[model samples]
Target: MSVTGTASDIASSESVPTSFGEFQPVGHVMVGLPTQGNVDALIDALHEAGWPPESLLRFTPGQSVEELQALVEGAGPLAGFGYEITLLRRYLELARNGYRWLLVKVDGTDEAAAAVQHARACHATLAVHYRRLVVEELL
Candidate 1:
């Protein structure tokens, strides 16, 4: 039998260890997070390290494709902050549950490092964000 609920509930449930223990990681881990004032701190850190504020883009899955495309293309010279059409489609499907997403592109490891540091400073938890982001999609 199968049971379902919000990702947080599923993830935190006692049954998860038994039910999902068979799963294994397929590759190295990468992480992402959302923040409050932490976003400003991250932006500042990135900019100090040479990644401009324009290097980040925010999108919600409910947006139309045309609207998404226009927003990406309309960035004009600021386009290609490493965004891909496929990412939009993936997020569109993944983020239907009122989760806002931020895409970050850093020119170097230093910027990436700073971003993570800022996220940690803001107490961002990717797992919780992931849960909120996918609650509707899973149901």
Candidate 2:
């Protein structure tokens, strides 16, 4: 399915991540889909499930690869001390393989669970919920 909405309606300002550190993307679920079609469907499903448009961010493979490259290049020594770096590498690999991404803002386990349901329905290849001190794989 093709994405149907204005940029503001379908994407958040944080489409490009600021960093790949341990604390980055806390309170969000990062979902990766194998195709643009899956990404578009997941966005629609999330909206129908009452997730606000501003809480969703979409990233193309190109954008994902570019941002990840910059983040990896600028990472500090401690970046390797956590699973964040490993996750970043995985995301980079997926992006290189043409997977798209959706970053959804979630308040807690309940919200993350809800998002994961839609992600699963839309065939998301990866879904990771970033909590305050833990990264939980939801799919």
Candidate 3:
């Protein structure tokens, strides 16, 4: 129920753990959206899907790294869904190149599913994979 892949060791000789269960952030989901145009509908859809206004983490191009980091950190870990920090950083890089991203964490299975469905209906992207927490145990 865990993966041993390091952020910098994607090709390293290590065991890649995998599992399915009530994983960490078990009921949360992240939504990606376009940064331009009218996003009010998408935001409204998210709220209608049970996501609180305070749970949204919206990032746009030209946003400073510190600002984005602060927003992500403020949303806390569970809201990160299954994306690793490295991957999140990569997302930021993409954003800098004109890709807008919306990151959110809904609080339950129904709500997460609703959000995902609504996102897809609205043409936004969704990520709902279960991520195992990587912990190092020395014996």
Backbone collisions counted per model = 0, 0, 0
lDDT, candidate 3, equals 0.45
Cα lDDT, model 2, residue 8: 37
* Per-residue lDDT of candidate 2, residues 15-111 (tens digit): 4544444336888999999998888888888887778788887775567777766666566888877688788888878889888878899999999
TM-scores for candidates 1 onward, in order: 0.35, 0.86, 0.51
Best model per lDDT: 2
How much is 77 displaced in model 3, in angstroms? 18
Number of the top TM-score candidate: 2
Cα-based RMSD of candidate 3: 14.3
Clashing pairs in 3: none
Which has the higher lDDT value, candidate number 2 or candidate number 3?
A: 2
Evaluated at residue 76, the lDDT of candidate 2 is: 81
Which tens-of-lDDT digit does each residue in 99-138 have in candidate 1?
3334454434444455555555544343111121121110
| Prediction 2 TM-score vs. true | 0.86
Q: Runs in model 2 with CA error above 4 Å? A: 1-23
